[model samples]
Target chain A: MDEFSFIDSIKPDSYRQSSLIKGIDDDAAVFRQNTQDIVTAVDTMVDGIHFSRETMEPYSIGYRALAANLSDLAAMGAEPAFFMVSIVIPSDWAEQELQEVYRGMASLGDGYRMDMIGGDTVSGKEFAISITVFGYVERNKARYRTAALPGDILFVTGTLGDSRAGLECINKKIDNEYLIQRHCQPSPRITFAEQLSSFNRVALNDVSDGIASEGSEIAEASCVDLHIAYDSIPYHSSIAELFPNQYQEWILSGGEDFELLGTISEREWPEVQQKAEELNLSVTKIGYVSEARESKGLVYLTMDGRTERLEKSGYTHLQEGRD
Target chain B: MDEFSFIDSIKPDSYRQSSLIKGIDDDAAVFRQNTQDIVTAVDTMVDGIHFSRETMEPYSIGYRALAANLSDLAAMGAEPAFFMVSIVIPSDWAEQELQEVYRGMASLGDGYRMDMIGGDTVSGKEFAISITVFGYVERNKARYRTAALPGDILFVTGTLGDSRAGLECINKKIDNEYLIQRHCQPSPRITFAEQLSSFNRVALNDVSDGIASEGSEIAEASCVDLHIAYDSIPYHSSIAELFPNQYQEWILSGGEDFELLGTISEREWPEVQQKAEELNLSVTKIGYVSEARESKGLVYLTMDGRTERLEKSGYTHLQEGRD
Candidate 1:
């Protein structure tokens, strides 16, 4: 089918929102939000680099592409409003495959109450999808990675290492449904971010490049030192049971968990924890921010109680060959 | 270089605006505009399909990718604010080549006072750049292609067929600087759009997919028939001087001129023409919107004064194989 026909077939009428002035069938999409601040992010996923067609379904690819961008907005304590997707598919791909991709995106978009407003569909030598998410936050309420104070307590929402473990499960042909699902469709911690931002959290970031990398980023951005306790870092229960030996490595260095990692003041820690409990979320206090000393930035207390510098290494696409 | 290092090295310190709350080094970029309405557009350009690496520079590729999206915003009569780029580059490309791409985008971004806010860079089998531009238009002042009425005069900003002629020059090794530059870096009609929109255009569209296709689009959207005069259609001077035989074909069916095409009521035509002249822009009256009858939408008059139905065939990516 042609481009227009394909777009028309998948166009969702339910995407209309009061804020949207215009949607598809125009040169550009128009919208309005009352909030004074807007959070925007763009992410691209390549077939071989981000996922493999052999392992992932087309729907999962589409879902994960938007999930990655939504995760960025979540980290910024922004409520997702809408997103645009630009997809370049291989010439050989069938119309059904493209439809499935949109279906997957619609499913996730519906859950987030965000619309797929506008985008471009083109032909390329390989399959790639680029998603741009727009979200809103009140002025001065949008969280940043540059506000963690020396006395801030660090916390993370949801378990880590599951996505990495899921990848391992797929590679090893392990029959771990949860692990594979986690890898294929990791959820963005939007609600957790909303709850934490309501309490005016300090620094915020999503654990996309492993806890180690994210911790260092917060430390560098806020001009502070981070002290993480290895035992306090929450690992997926499946990881501990299925691959106990790799739990620490996966929890500290594994990526694509899409969990919110942030810092809060000591005074607000109790209330933040209570709020997380109210939200029925698994929020864990795993570290503390301190003034930069001789060995500035990320330092970790090992399981054996020895302090060591945490390496700023994780899922750097240029180095690791994947997102 | 790793992803972090590459991102840090090219990170523009000058991108910071008073409206930009946060930029790179965070999970997402944050910004706010005082305008009540926001306009967004996205376009993706593939390396081989959109422009071959042998014929185009990396910088031109980057510039054109963003330019395409900006053109869409221009068609909406929006003021350019910021844009994000998601790039997938082959692993074999040199770091300098990648830097050149950013430099190209930075050049255009600086011209429009638009920030390169945030995006993702990943490895792909081939090079592709997807750009999402965010702009703002005053509420009720934004232009649309669906608002034209019967007896509205069609006017296009700037000369047409230059970009296509430029492409032909490059393909045939014609060594025409004007044609080549027009093809490589066609300017988006933002200034013209800003001027004409002040006069309240009835309908608007960018001439991306040839005059015939765009004219048909505006006609169909507005539910009116467009009667275009063949002699009034503007062609670039270079096309007339260098390739006179192909001038008609290029003006009628060529794509990627990035010029604004729109309709204005006959009552507003004089004021619109004055505004275009004040802006030093070329605005030509080429057609008029008529009430839809049996053969509704688009029709054209030949040079000999004979009428014919205008075909909707232009640059459909699925049929043409690329943008």
Candidate 2:
């Protein structure tokens, strides 16, 4: 079939939102969401660079691609409403495999009522998927990394290093279903981020890259120093037992965690924990923001009454810096 | 540099619109435009599948990629506003060459005041660029292919087949600067489309995949038959002079024209011509819509008082169909 025919075969028959006046039929998709500000995030995942067939199933590949974009919106405290996907297919891929990819996305998006409005499908040598997600946040209420202030308590949602460890487990052929599932299915901290918007100001960043990279970003953007207590950062017990020497490396610098890392005021820290508890989420306070000293926007790891710069250790694609 | 640093290096230092609350610094770009309905179009161009270094310059590739998406929004009569880009860079490409790509997009977008809001940059094996554009149209005023009715006058803006001929010239190592320029630089009929949107109802489509595919799309969507006069279809004089035998084929099936095709009320035909004259746009009355007679939504080409079905003649990626 032609590109148009394939698009016709895959386009959603009916959209859930009346606001989505146009979907895939027209030259462009049309929609209006008037109640709040609009937030958009676009992410691209390639076959070799982002995932490999040996390690990632088609469904998990699709799921994680959308999940990464969703995590970005979650960090901004945006409620995702609509998404568009642009996928490049290789000739070897079957039509059924493509449907599995869509099914994977629907499994996640249907829960949030997010509609797949429009996208482009084309044949290429390598398989790649690019997803652009749109969401709404309250007017002028979208959280930013610059919102952190001195005396704010730094916190993270869920355990860190799970995704990186999970990826290692998959590569090593280790029999750890929990770790494998963690690598494949990352849950964006949307609920916690939504509640975070109620606070006066909370600097939020998602842990796609390791905490070292993410914490450094927040510090640089807010022009404040972050003092992370090394012993306080949480991780899965299995990761420590299985890879004791490398567990600290993964906890500090392993990427693709998809957890929320934010700095909130000391006064509101208790309330934030209570809300996380109410939602049955694991919220851990690992650090605090402080006025920049000695150097601007630096992150320090404090353990055993000794302080040292937290070095970025994750793999970087084009150069020697953590993601 | 790493992905984040590369993004920081290329992101716009300042934005023209206050509606853009956030740009590249955040996880997602946040913006609010309350005046009109939003229109979004996304297009992806790959190195080997869409174009190659042998036939296309990096700048033209970038320019044409954005142009195609802008043309989509134009077909819907949406005023272009902002766009985000997701690009995959191969190891061979230099940073300067990448900047040229951005320069190509900026050359067109700056004229329309469209801002580069946000996107992701990643490393991959092959070079690819996907652009997602956002525009605004008057509430419920956007045009669609389904709006055509019987007795509506069909029109097309600008000459067709130049791009296809240009591609042939490049492949054959022919030095025809005019055709090559026409192939590389396609001016979207945004001004004409904006004017057309003032009418009550007009069915519209962009001549991206040639008139055979585009006209058929409008016909099928509107559930009407289109009678196109073969003699009235406009083409560059050079095409007929240079390749007399294949000119008709190119005119009918040559894709990437980036011109607007629409059907409007017969009463508004004269006014449309007048507006075209005012705007210095070449608008041709080549056909009219009719009730579906023998076959629903079929397109017939008439020449010498004889009519024939217009078959799709362009190349398909995975199967046999145009575009």
Candidate 3:
């Protein structure tokens, strides 16, 4: 099918929302937010680099692409309202496969109450999808990485490194379904973020590029230093069971966890913990933020009781050597 | 350079705008507008299909991608504020070339006073960029393709078929700077659109997919028949000078002109013409919307007074059959 026909065929039933003044079939999508500030994010996933037909299904590809953008919104404590998806498909792919991709996107959009507003479909030599999500946040209350203050207690929601472990399993053809699922369909911590933001969290970011990388970002942005306790970091049980020797490396540098990494005041730590327990979310307090020392960068206190400089190691596009 | 460093390097100097609450460092960009509704549009351009390195420079590729999205916002009469760009670059591209691509984007963004707030960069087999633009329009004043009325006078800003003709010149290695420039950097009609919206134009769309395709879209969406005068449509002088025989085909079916195609009330025509003249914008009256005739689709009235059915033929993704 051509671009127009394919778009027509998958024309989603107008899932109307009060904020959506206009949806598809227009030059641009129109939306309104009475008093809240708007939060917008865009993320792109490419075929071979981000995902591959060899390791991922079309549905997962679509789901994860949107999930990445949604994770960004989640970090901002925004309620996703609409998303636009632009896809470039290789000619060899069947229309059924493309439909499967949309099906996956629709399923996720339904869960988030996000309407598919507008996008473009084009042909390319490789398969790729770029999703832009629009959401709304309470005025002046949206979290930012630069908001972390000295003496703030840092916490992370849910376990990290599962996605990286899952990727390893896929590459090695391991038979762990949990790890595989984690790798394929990592969840974005939207509900947890929303609850945390209600308490005026200090700073927040999603664990997309590993804890070490994300922690460094928060510290750098806020002109502070993060002291993380290696032993205090949370990880999935499978990490210790299957990759015992490499678990620490994975926990520190494994990317794509999509969990919320944030900081809060020491006084509010108990209340934040209680709220997480109420929401049935696993919240781990792993570090603290402090004024930067004279000559040191991010500090990692290892299990061996030794302090070391934290290196910025994670999944970066050019560094992957995948030319 | 890795994605992080590259993004950091090009961090645009803080072009402070009152509406922008947060810029590139945040998880998602935040902005505010008191009463105006938000408008968003996304467009993607890919290697080979959209433009090849052999025929176009990286700057043009990036400029055209943003221009396409800006054109959509222009059609809605939105004042461009921010745009997020996500790019996938093949590994073979030098870092300088990638920077040139961003230079192109920054040039266009500067012209429109649009900020590049947030985006993602990744690796891919082919180079591609997707841009999502955010703008605002006065409440209930945004134009829509569905708003065209039966007696509304159809009009288009600037000349059509120039982009297509330019493509032909490039393909044939003809040294015509005007045609080539038209194809590479067709300006979006933002100022004209804003002026027309102030006058409450009936309906509007950009001429991205030729006059016939865009006209038929407005007609079908509004459930009215558009009677277009074939010879009355405006064209570039280069089309007549070079491809006289094919000029009609280019005018009717050639795509990517990026001119605003709109309609206005007959009573508003004289004032609209005056406004266009004051703005130094060339607008041509092409046709008028009419009550739909039974079992007949969009109609084309030729110069010889012969009526013909208008076929939906412009640029379509898969129809081009480029693998």
Candidate 4:
């Protein structure tokens, strides 16, 4: 079969039963979400760079590609509407493996109610997956990172360093089931993150690279200093016990934990709690903020009964600063 | 450097200008195009599959990866906006070569005013690049393959099969300039293709995978027959001499031509001609559609003035279809 026919064959049919002039053909696939804000984001995942080349499964590749992108949509407090994916892999890759990746992605898409609109498949010198997610938020209702005020309380969803520590533990052949699961699939706190309502002047972001890195970014972007309480910071007990010397650093800097770090007003703290309980999400208040100038607009915190200057933690793609 | 650190080291400072509410550190990045009509597509390119690993430059790889995806956006009649690129390659690839690749992409992006939003970089078993493009067209100007109806005239933009023929000539070391140039950098017809208005119904699609295969798809999806007069087809003189025995077949089925095939009404024919001449675009009438029948569909008029059946003519990634 020709490549065109192959695309035509594998391309998923649109289940959308609305005014869709084109599903997948032409210069683009058109989607009309009447009177709705068009939310969009793009994510690309590389092979060994993002995942373990030694033992990672192809299905995990598909899942992570879509999950990582979808998590972006969630970070914006937007509902994922639709997405398109592009895949490039070696010519000799097993056809079944490709399908497995698609199946994993489609499963996540199903969970998020985001339709897989269309994508392209090609043979490349390496494996690369790119996903573009389209989502929607009410007019001006979407969240941002610059909204954190001086007194606002900072909180992160679920646990931190689990995924990062998981990778390390798994590498060492440690018999820790919880850590392994975290490394395998870190839950995206989409539901909890999106429930953050407007009017709270809430600043929102997800922790992928690491908590301290993302915290400082939000702080720097907002021109505020993140005042963290190390004791209040959440983590997996297994990680703490296994790597005592590195626990604090890993918890602060270890990346790839797809959790949410949001700031809400002190007045709305109770509401945040109520909403979390209502949504069945764990809302942990781990820190607060002070003057940007007081700390050079960086992350500082109280740890072990001392006012310790918290070093920037997390993966820094750049040489100078954290992500 | 660790694989993760390598990805980190390659981070560009312009990422801060992504205008994404929360980026890089989060599960996803978010942006709103503020346009109501959303159009999207994705394309992937593999190494040693789409290009010669030995002869092809890294910059060419980046340029073509983007050009191919942008061509898809153009075919949809959507204004090119933003794109996401994902690349997975062997870790041994020189850092400078990767820089050249990005430089080429950034140059194209600068010319097109398209943003390099986000993507993944991983070390893979093979080299692969996946790009997903998000664009928007005016609601009143949305075009689709299903929009084509009876009485519509099929049209093709530019000449066809030059890319394939050019590649063949290069592989054979044909002592020709045109063939090698065409193979190296086949220009995508982005500007002139939009002359075909959107108010007009079109079974329009790009000749990316090949005219025959894409044409067949337009016919198949629209549930109509594509009747092509082989003599009406346009071609480069070099291609005509390169594949003498199967020149027509190659043009019809050859992939990567990046020309466009679409249908327009007889009433719009005058305007199309005026615009084509204005834009210096070659607008060739290949065939017209006939009534849907039980068995008579996808017809081709031979050069000897004989009618014959046409098959899907394009490249497939399967090993058997490879050169």
Scoring each candidate complex against the real one, what DockQ results?
A: 0.77, 0.76, 0.84, 0.49
Q: Candidate 1 regions off by >4 Å?
A: A294-296, A315-323, B294-296, B299-303, B315-323
Q: Which ten residues in a row have the lowest lDDT in candidate 3 chain A?
A: A314-323
lDDT of 1: 0.83
Top model number, lDDT: 2
TM-score of chain B of each: 0.92, 0.94, 0.94, 0.87
Query: Among these predicted structures, which one has the highest DockQ?
Result: 3
> On a 0 to 1 TM-score scale, where does candidate 3 land against the true structure?
0.95
lDDT of 2 at A119: 88
* Model 3 accuracy (lDDT, Cα): 0.84
Q: lDDT tens string, model 2, A209-292? A: 889888988998899999899899999999998788777788888889899999999999999999999999999999999998
CAPRI band of model 1?
medium
Candidate 1 local lDDT, A86-147, one digit each (tens): 99989888999989888888888788788888889999889998998988887888888888
Question: Model 4 over residues A1-323: C-alpha lDDT tens digits?
Answer: 24555566557776552534466555567777665455666667766667754656777778877777766666777777777877765566677777777887877787776666777766665566778887776656667777788999998877888877777776788878888776665566677656774454778777777777788778876889888887898887878889887777777778767778888889988888887898877779999877787645777766656565555544232222221
What is the per-residue lDDT of model 3 for residues B1-323, given as tens digits with 9 covering 90 to 100? 67777888778878656799899988899998878989998998888988888889888888888888889999998999998988988889888888888898889889878889988888888988999999989999888988888888989988988999999999999889998999998899888888876675569999898877888788788878888887788988888899987877788778899998888889998887888899898998999888878554364544555566676664233123212
lDDT of 4 by residue, B185-277 (tens): 666666665555544565568888777677777777677777777778889887777688756657777778777788888788777777888
Residue-level error in angstroms, candidate 4, position B205: 0.7
Model 4 chain B weakest 10-residue run by lDDT: B314-323
Least lDDT summed over 10 consecutive residues: which range in candidate 1 chain B?
B314-323
User: Please, what is the TM-score per model?
Assistant: 0.94, 0.95, 0.95, 0.86
Q: Give the per-residue Cα lDDT of candidate 3 at A286.
A: 95
lDDT of 2 by residue, B1-323 (tens): 46555666678878876678898887889989787899998999888877886678878988888999999999999999899999988888877778788888988988898889988788888788999999999999999999999999999998988988888888888888998888887888888889877798989999988998899889888899998998999999988887777777788878889998899999999999998999998999999999988656878788666677775554232122221
TM-score of chain A of 3: 0.94
Task: Give the proportion of true interface contacts each model preserves, from 0 to 1.
Answer: 0.88, 0.70, 0.91, 0.73
Name the lDDT value of residue A44 in candidate 1. 89
Candidate 4 DockQ score? Answer: 0.49
